[model samples]
Target: MTKSLIDILDLSTGEIDELIETANRIIENPQAYAHKCEGKKLATLFFEPSTRTRLSFEAAMYELGGHVLGFSEAASSSASKGESVSDTVRVVSGYADIIAMRHPKEGAPMVASMKSLVPVINAGDGGHNHPTQTLTDLLTIRRKMGRLDHLTVGLCGDLKFGRTVHSLIGALSRYEGIRFVLISPQELTIPDYIREEVLEDGHQDYVETTDLEAVMPELDILYMTRVQRERFFNEADYIRLKDSYILTREKLDSAKKDMCILHPLPRVNEISVDVDEDSRAGYFDQALYGKYIRMALILKLLGVE
Candidate 1:
């Protein structure tokens, strides 16, 4: 059976630490690992639209001396001709050394992985999981704070439908002394599986609040998420909740001196552009880390020495 990253839990805590260490080393000496994936090929089969994740995977492969091939949208692939994910991945897997797939439905990537001839990565599958993004978030947290544990992390905005938020919480729950301030409206609170199964089951400390400012002071890391319009079934409900949390320069006044603000990018109006000038803004840096961490992940998945 071929290995795949269908969920963040697929990797142990030690593996995450190893990936973070590899990413840091790559940051320090990128030239040395340039040829790690030479002669390898990566297939990016994005059935949904994406700018950052897709490009980062492509860029990671390129930087690792590997080639990238695949469609950026479903219509561009054989899926437009009514081909199943299993067939598409099985065929593509024969052509590429690894596969990264994103689909609108949950567990689609898992199905793809079972049929894939090589390693398969879930670029994203609905609002289910995006393990690589979780890996990126972990790397960003480790880089900025120098520690992943013993800190209060604030996760603000659409926790109910944000896959990145779900994945982040799952990954962070493994660490010691990690308190979560889940900031969202009552209507947009986190899923029961995460709250009951992951947090409550693990006996992790957490608090849910509708106010972002009230918890801003206590946070060492603030992970903000946009209220995604696509996830909503009703337009009226989305319009009402979309502006629930907006992080601005003034909001940072109450925050800790060294608090790091992170966002899984392509942010809508959730984060004001002016906050980009703030010293604590780590979202852009977070995106850059995504590429390096993905580079490390590609190396690991491909069994590259």
Candidate 2:
């Protein structure tokens, strides 16, 4: 059977640690592993529009001395002509050493994995999960805060549809003393399944609040997510909270000086531009880490490292 990274659960804690270590090494000395995947080819089958994720995968493949081929958006692909994901995977597997796919439908990659001859990677699948992003988050947190354990991480903004938050909570649940402050509107609160399956079952300490300022001082890491206008059911609701949860300069006044701030980019103003100047704002640096980790991922998946 071929291996696939469909979920964070697919990797043991030790494997996760090794991957992070490899990623750190790749970041520190890119040239040492430049030809790691010398003759490999990577096919990125993105069924959604994600500039950052797509480019990260492409850059990763290139840095590993591998070639990359794939479409950036669904409309540009065979999917627009009604090609099934399974058929797409079967076809791409013939041409590439591995396939990384992103789809708007939940569990799409899982279905593709069953048919794929090469390894499959879930770039994302609706709000279901994004394991690679979770891996990137884990590596970023460990690199920045020095450890993932015993940190109070505040996940602020759209909790219901933020796949990154769901994946992060799952990844951190395996660690100890990692408290969460899930800040979101009641309508956009963390789903019942997440609360029941992860927070409650793990017995992790967490608080749900609409107030961002009240939780700012208590956080070791503040993970901001976009309060997407498209996620709201009504225009008035979007207008109200779009400005409500913004992390502004005034709001950061009382926050700990050393607290780290992170965001999955293409942000629609959830974090203020002024806050970017702060040393603790690590999202841009975090984005670069995504590419590095992805480079490590491609090498590992191709059995080269």
Candidate 3:
């Protein structure tokens, strides 16, 4: 049977640690892993527009000595011609060794994985899940903090529809002493399913607040997220909450000097540019780590490790 990554929960904590270990190896020595995927092809079927995820997937394949071929947006694909996701993925499976897909609809990749003949990676499915991003987040956290357990993780911004936030919480909940500080406007608080199913049921320590500054001092990792305009049904509501938590240097004073500041990029004023120079800012390095972790994932899914 072929392996697919549609949700972060699909991967065990041990598997995550292995992937991080592999990623660190790739980081320390890139040439040794080059050509691991030689002659294999990765087809990226993105139904939505993206810069980081898509490019990183492509870069991952390329760095591993593989080829890439796919459309970047729906308009560029047969989806623009009324093609179903299952049909698109089924067809692409014949042409490529693997597929990494992103769609605007939640569970579309799950639908694709069912029909795909090859392994399927869900890049992002609406605001439901982004397993690879969650992987990247995990690797970033493990590298920066030197451990995944016994720390407070501050997730701020649009948590209600933030798939990265949802996936990260689910993954981290498996670790010991994982406390979550959820900061977002009341309208953009985390989904109840996450709060109930993941946090409450797992007995994870957490607190919900709209205030970012008040909880800064306690966080070991501050994962900032953008208030996605695309996830909002109402523009006015998006406009109101978009500026909810901008991390400035002054705010960093309250945070631990060793605290790691992470953000899933393409910022929309949720993070101040001045914070980029701070030693705590790991978001940029976080983006770079995405490539290496993705390289490990591609190798894993391909059975080429």
Question: Candidates 1 and 2: which is better by TM-score?
Answer: 2
- The TM-score-based order of candidates, best leading, equals 2, 1, 3
lDDT of each: 0.92, 0.90, 0.92
Off by over 4 Å in 2: none
Query: Model 2 over residues 1-305: C-alpha lDDT tens digits?
Result: 57888988888888888899999999889999898888899999999988899999998999989899999899999999999999999999999999999999999999999999999999999888788888888899999999989999999999998889998999988888989999998779999999999999889899999999988899999999988788889999888877778988888888998898988887778888998898889899889999988887777787885
Q: Please tell me which predicted candidate would have the highest TM-score against the true structure.
A: 2
lDDT of 1 by residue, 24-82 (tens): 99999999988888999999999999999999999999999999999999989999999
Can you give the TM-score per candidate against the true fold? 0.95, 0.96, 0.95
| Least accurate 10 contiguous residues by lDDT in model 3 | 237-246
Backbone clash numbers for all candidates listed: 0, 0, 0
Q: Whole-model lDDT, candidate 2?
A: 0.90
Q: Candidate 3, which segments miss by more than 4 Å at Cα?
A: 228-244
lDDT score for candidate 1 against the true structure: 0.92
If both were scored by lDDT, which would come out higher, candidate 2 or candidate 3?
3
